[model samples]
Target chain A: MSTTSTTAPSRTSRTSRPRRRLARFGSTGFIAALPFLAPALVAYLVFVVAPALESVRLSFFEWSGFQGAPQVFVGLQNYVRIFTHDPVFWTALSNTVIWVILSLVIPVGLGLVMALALNRKIFGRNLFRSVFYIPGVLAPIAIANMWRWMYNPNYGIGVNLAQLFNLPWLADVQWLGDKNLALYSIFAAFVWQIAGTNMVLFLAGLQGVSPDHVEAAKLDGANRWQVFRNVVMPSLRPTTVVVVVLTIINSIKVFDLIVGMTGGGPAQQTQVLALWSFQQSFNNHEYGSGNAIATVLLVITLIIVVPYMVWTAKQEKNS
Target chain B: MTVTAIPTAAAPVANPSPKRKPRPLSRGRDWVRVGLWVALLFSVLIWAVPLIFMVFTSLKSEADIFGTPAFVPPWAPEWGNYVEALDRGHLLTAGGNSLIVAIIKVPVGLFISAAAAFALSRIRFKRQRLLMGVIALGAMVPIQVAIAPLFQVINGLNLLSTNLGLILPYIAFGLPYQTFILYGFFRQIPEEIDESARIDGAGNWRLFLTIILPLAKPALAALFILDFVATWNEYSIALALLQSQDSWTIPLALQGFQSQFTSSYGPLNAFTIMSVFPVLIVYLMFQRYFVEGAFAGAVKG
Candidate 1:
């Protein structure tokens, strides 16, 4: 066996030099990549991976933040309370779903339409693209603050239009104050800011479709609607999937717009899971419950995100 | 790679004729096209109207903001709001904080993400594929979800309220996405170069730095700019970590200002306008790169 192992290399290359070279190559790669690999591994493990696991551990504890020596482990009590006992938790989660659906449905729908329009060799296409995409490029703080005024109820256009048209906006029915309208209003601001991103993605997807197919469809007497439905939609599936995933993730994580516009208020109508998590951790100092909520979100995210990622990777492998 | 086929028809006609008579607007395509342009222009106007209102409100007096029916402010606009918002120190300090965070974050984030992406993409190992999948899934985890435990870790490390502390967490949260994008770009690079580099006695570090990094400049630039913008505008983590007024970044300061100026629309609007310009300038300056980068980092992958 030893003789055969030694002779295998000699049979192929007739020398020990290439074996040494291969060994050197392998070692060199390992050594060279260590610097790059170590920092990322350490930082991510220390800050991300460890904390995530620790959060799951902490979710079982009852503790106040920064004022205690240690926390008491309560074992599923935190999760139990969040699910059954807490009104705010359910409200926050429902609001998140509401925001996600509204924001995703509108922005993605409009984006696909816009992408179809802009994908053509239309005049002033750049101008139109820029106008739509500007909101995306601007800082979130800027978009949020600007929209706060735009929704200002009195001097703002929304309120002004309602009043001028003899419909009371801020006076009779508070858009930001009403529970039903507040979440929807927040969703509107979010859609306005992020629609451009989806549009850009869809535009990229639309451009990926060859013009010949489109022209051929036209020659076959396929109407614009038919061509779009049959030819355009199927080709754009991956992009749609990506857009959907990103929109869902973005919707789930939305915080700045809610904080800037509503502060989760008139009476917790617009409170989302993210803001709720933050409020629990920082405002209420209930670190355990907060961490519990965070852990739940992480698990939920995995349930959605993992399958999609694996599916994409599998698609890539197959392709 | 979908192939298209040409339809066979008559080779030539005695007199080539243009086909029309399907739709009324087909005869005057120019006018219909013009109408489409007008409709597009109107939709754009709808998008811009709110921005214009914000600008006008910023320039108007508090009283004028309500009283004036004038879409365009009458006479010389009141620019006092800009002065007042600045004097309040919210915009100035917060802008400075955001700038500091962004500047530090860009290089740090780029190096880490690039290195990690390089290893993940190029290194063939048993665990590489699994690690890549993990990080991609990590990208989808909400930052808010991580906030609680992160606060626990940060407070334990005594990093609360310090810029470094805030910056550390931001970098951590940003890595999964940044690395995911960069990994895709890195993988697209041909393997021949790395083989050739190894043959030339170039070490992996030397090869990565000299060959791969130079080739990955566009991807790196795109990642750097995105990290900058995201870190710049980030609020939730910053809000939670930064409790002190002085340590506050622009988004937090804007939140603080929002409460203070809840009654006065002028200064609030002015501050909002002012707050956006730094980010605007960055975006415009790298507008070409931003557009191309969006496609490269996003579309292909």
Candidate 2:
């Protein structure tokens, strides 16, 4: 080899070696990140991390909020009250499960169907998709408020529709009153509000599916149902999983919909975990019990999310 | 494999290529497909009914809304309902508050999240990975649970009943997700550019401002819109932080309007329509970017 070429490799190796090795250890590039990370670190510590730690600490102390310093440290008494004593806690838990299941099923299933339909060469594809997704883009408070008006019995659509058919809609039977029907009524509103965005997500996933594979399936004499089962459904499974997980998580955190629609009303029948925690901590002035509920909610959310995250991470590695 | 053996099947379509003859559609099969579409359309209408009802109620007079013939208003259409709603509710003031927050929040949040994401992407540090993990985990926790202590923390800082108070939490709540997104984008840009810049003696800030920021403009714009929409529409925090009427955001004020005027659906509906207009306009303007940003970090391999 020429001396010049030989010298080039030696210099190249020397210069690139540190950068490559640093990338491997992921440690070489530190200075560039400092300015950006500093502010975020401070804010996270103060606003997010501190509050989370305080919640754990506050769960043990019995207090009526800022009224006075916590009178006593009950130590697990607050937690025990939830599992053993509080019927409301159990109701909220059950309501949470119901809400999660409903949210997961309706939004994902409807979203899939909507995506498939909208994916066709429809004349007004953009218009239709945009209209369906309007609810999701509108702020949550606005959508919830709109739904609240629609559910109003007097001069509201529900009343007018019921009167058109001569049925007692909101007056005789409490849409918000009956314990059995109350949760479902609130759920109906949620499904409407979320189905749009979920549909958009599913559409993106469907579009990502390779058209060649779909064409191959069609050429193989697969019927509509057979094609859907063997090709489209499997192709869409990952998107479905994403949708389901997000839906379930959002359901657990549901507050605005219930607050706007019913305020967990007619009785405590409609109260989910988020609203329950807010009521206990803020409204009822029971800080310890409220924190206890929040802690359990946090744990439960982790229980669902942590495993799924680990599983997905492993799946990503294997794939 | 037998068709039945394949439990998960994709819908099959007949080939429409000119080289291949199109398969005949049996009458029965065609009828079944049409029937399904009809059923689906009706289901969609059922879903749309509540929204349609809201629009209709807003047009009717109070007497028409109350009278025996509830379907038919006693008089003609009422544009006055909107005027009355504007007068009754502090709709304009509440809207102004929402606009101010969204306007302020977008740039601040984009700066914070984008800056953090840029650092995490460009620089290598062990602490960076750990910090990223902490943020990911925090995203799973519900914000509602954090409200009580968050309020306490804000109050301790003496920001209560101020726009700064609400703005602080809004930015904090939005940071993680926005960071997650921008970081993903920043990392995608090849490191060759950075190395070339270093060779030319571009300092860190100059490289970022000149080379990196311009390239990352699309991602920043996307984050701005997403943060704006989230902040503008946010309620639970607004309700908690801003106790006074002057500080109430649009959503909070709208809720207050509903309770105050139990009999008047016109103004309430009118208020709903007005409040949603600005959001809809923004959405329409930057819609392509909004959809792209939303699904960007979400579809991680």
Candidate 3:
């Protein structure tokens, strides 16, 4: 190892191990952060950053996917094919959009209402919070299996419970069978698992609402709804951002639950980009087209994620 | 394995949550209070029904499943379902595989995350916020975008279908969230400790090991349990990486196990019930920290 820096002789004469001065290169000083940064930086670059970059590259190239088959660069052909020829792409894109839109509505709608309901100093608040949140801790596959069993056509709980309760109309409704209803049915199960998450976040936000502000509003001729609207809602904007961003991102990448539930079935009406990306590559061996869908998914995510990160960076600077 | 976005908004800065009590109702006005209670219970019942059905169904015989109504509990508890699940599903083996993956991934992941966090926090460097922003964005990026290429990379490394292959990517994916959490934590530790330690001739490594890490114990503990649960429940990377059934983690194995017992959901439900215990035990024991972890992990897609 040689100290190639021209000024190293002066620094080295001051101390045997002039660590900070000796390690300086390219207008930077401090060597301490390097050892600590190396493992994580190297691993992340190789495994995550490099592969993620490859996914974009793979989108532009076609390969036969055989033993040592050479990949041929085919610039926008994969994207053009997906846009022009693939109807499933439209269904998946629409389904994913619906999934993202409803995720902001149903589950989190239930979440907001529940959070407001539970924000009081009620008895059993902890119990109720745990009840709603426990489903989230279970694996998505487990949740899928649980919901699938309940949706069974003949002996499902929907049928049996309808029978026991003497409701004839509810017994024959196919939850996961019909094409139009399958995506929504999966969303229902998704709500069962996710509503609690939104609730907890809202609850955190609610707790942060200064009690003094609520009291001052109460003192000035405000009702409960008025105080909530004026005082509580404004303070909760940050938490709501976290909750909404979390929902959109999670909704977009949802694959395991869909995979376990329908496998994009019933004539492939329920395919989302995440599962489509996986199936196109692994199942159909169309690596090029799969990467194209994945890149679309990546761009969709970046649009949302980038702004949120910028906001957090701003927050960090201030904090 | 724990995933989340940058949580500057809800890092739980140890706030003292002061509850606001509702005005006490007098006499006939009690209907308002009563109505609130009714709404609460009704909503709870709706939420609890599916879980209640799972518990009830797990304890019934195959004959009783069709014989009885869906809501009823078993007249006599049937432990046989659990036995068949444990005995035949080779679930114990899958359980071991899951545990092994968690055991390896959690500590290794935590070390890198904490070290990276330490560098980002304590060590002076330019582009710290840029690096921090990159990590925060990485934490939020959907893992699906990295899937196909990650598979190719693993194949190239000759580690396809191995637990190491599964966990290496798992660790890489885990770093962003864990580092983000620990970075928030490490920033909160006072600077005086670092100042005095350096005067005592302590180097960065010694200061980190002896002083800073000890002060960050609570954060580390919270991260520890959260990371464990996340690793234990992770599905996607395992799906893309762990192809062989022999190396399948719990979630992957559950999907495989379900196909075998499609006719008899008895063993399948039993296995699902059994699988919940480890997660349930840890969750219940550390319920307080989990709320934080859950909030912290909310951004995980």
Candidate 4:
């Protein structure tokens, strides 16, 4: 490579001395970058990128995850089974959609309201901010476990509250054990864990809103609701975009909480796409179908995320 | 029409330019402030309830846990619950495993990512944007999609149930965001510093080690705390890879402990509290950096 570079410099010298120097600089820069890039590149390719691509390839084959097992190339049969015949796949997909909607609506709405409220120069402002954000930092496993016991029928806070108020009908609601209420029950816990993150993000965005504009709108005889809707909401669009996209991504990746709280139980009612994939691949050992579900999740995620990411990169470049 | 007419009649009285204060307006504002305070208090209680309950339950004896009203504070704060958890729940060993993973992975992962970020941001290469784009895209790819094949790869390499198994993937998965964040910081450093260092006959390696890293210390610290918390709390990869009880991280151990001691709420809460305490401390100590790091990628994206 050095020999080639030396010979090329001689050929390029006829063009211009500065041009030849610039070419040398570029080449040297590339060479210097190679060693620095190697470690992360190699690990990312082998562990992250390669495995992702391999999942796509594995989705086309049938394998049961046994030692000495042969992989059978089955074409699009796995996809066909998931889309056309499987009931659980449909259930998981629909539940994932519900999870996405719940995440998008409840958390984002609550966060926006809280951000608006906390945007005021209230007493204990920082204390309230920290208190709300504490749950966001705790492990989902720990949060799920804590909430799981909180939903316990016999001695849980939920039932106890119902009984304390003489609400006999609510006492035996069976938060996690009822198939009808299980998914929403887990979602309530999830919202408790995640709403704070959205709130903080919105709070940051709210802080960025120009006080001058808000005052100007109020001076123009705008009511409080009108001021918030016209001025504050528009200013928070970027944060809303971020919160919505992140919530969607997080909703799709919901696994640990479900594993901890319900184990996709109460008759597989709360099964999500990611958890179903785990069950299929690891528990059932049906690698082909599992990979197919994973592929579907990846495709769905990228369809929403890739364009946004590219746009963000372009915005960063322009800035 | 009367409503509009009344407001117009009162407009002059309410619209003082610079001299007089509006008593009704101040009274209304005070009410809103009081309402906001009430809402803020409610939000705090909602967020703190589970944590408060966890602490209270952890301190309760078994009889107290089963017998007392759920809202009542533990009559006797059983410090022995923590001892029982440590002795029987495997919390100590699992915590050590988590600490080891975080210790080994965070610094090493930060170095590799920072080096790559330096290359992408500081070094003038032709395909630097493309490389950065690839890494950015890689950040969005969920680990769930790669779990099956990654499991096979780790198992094939005979690294399953080992610290290396968790560390390798943790670093790999952590690199993209770390690189992106460090790239932002690295780009903020003036190129003239590098030029002067080069003029002093310092090589690229020496310049990075001596000048660039020290300058990037804040970013490094932020990523350190963020990555440490994330690695310590990681569950999916650890669950899929670590099979043995002895090799389990805190999350895995907690799951196993929960299942085994399904009815032992006191010890379970103790285990939960112990596992989350380190992260809580780090977060409280570095609150500003923690929030900044969390928002860096999202706001930038």
Scored by lDDT, the top model is: 4
Lowest summed lDDT over 10 consecutive residues: which window, candidate 2 chain B? B1-10
lDDT of each: 0.76, 0.74, 0.80, 0.84
Error of 4 at B161 (Å): 0.5
**Top of the candidates by DockQ:** 3
Model 2: per-residue Cα lDDT over A110-168, one tens digit each: 87788777766433445556666767767666677777666665545656667678877
> Can you write out model 3's per-residue Cα lDDT over A1-319, one digit (the tens) per residue?
3656756786666443333432332212246688888888887888888888898999999965444988999999999999999999999999999999999988888988988887665666667777888887888888888888888887787798788889987788888888988998898889998998788778766756889999999889899799988998999888888788889978998887898889998789889999998889888989999989999988888888887788777886697
Per-residue C-alpha lDDT of model 4 across residues B1-301, encoded as one tens digit per residue: 1111223222233433645555775888878788879978987887888888889999999999888887788877999989988888888899899999999999999999989988887666787888898987777777899999999999999999999999999999999989987887787777667766766777667777899998877568667876888898999999899998899999998998899999989999999999899999988886653343234332242
State each model's C-alpha RMSD to the native: 7.2, 6.4, 7.8, 9.3
Model 3 pairs in collision: none
Model 4 misplaced stretches (Cα beyond 4 Å) = A1-29, A317-319, B1-25, B190-192, B195-202, B288-301
- Structure candidate 4, residue pairs in collision: none
lDDT of 4 by residue, A190-221 (tens): 98888878887787677567899999999999
lDDT of 1 by residue, B1-301 (tens): 0011001111123323435444764757667667777888888888777688888888888678777752756366888989998997477888888889899977997788888888877655456778878777768888777777787788889988989998787777788888888888787777667776778987767877899888877667666776777788888888778889999998888878888768778888788888878777887776544432254334245
| TM-score of each model, in listed order | 0.89, 0.87, 0.89, 0.89
Q: lDDT per residue, candidate 3, B149-253, as tens digits?
A: 999889899998888898889889889888887887787776656666776767778878898888877667667776787788888888888877788888877
Candidate 2 lDDT: 0.74
lDDT of 1 by residue, A82-146 (tens): 99988888888888878778777899998877776666556667678777777886767667778
Better of 1 and 4 by lDDT: 4
Backbone clash total for model 4 is 0
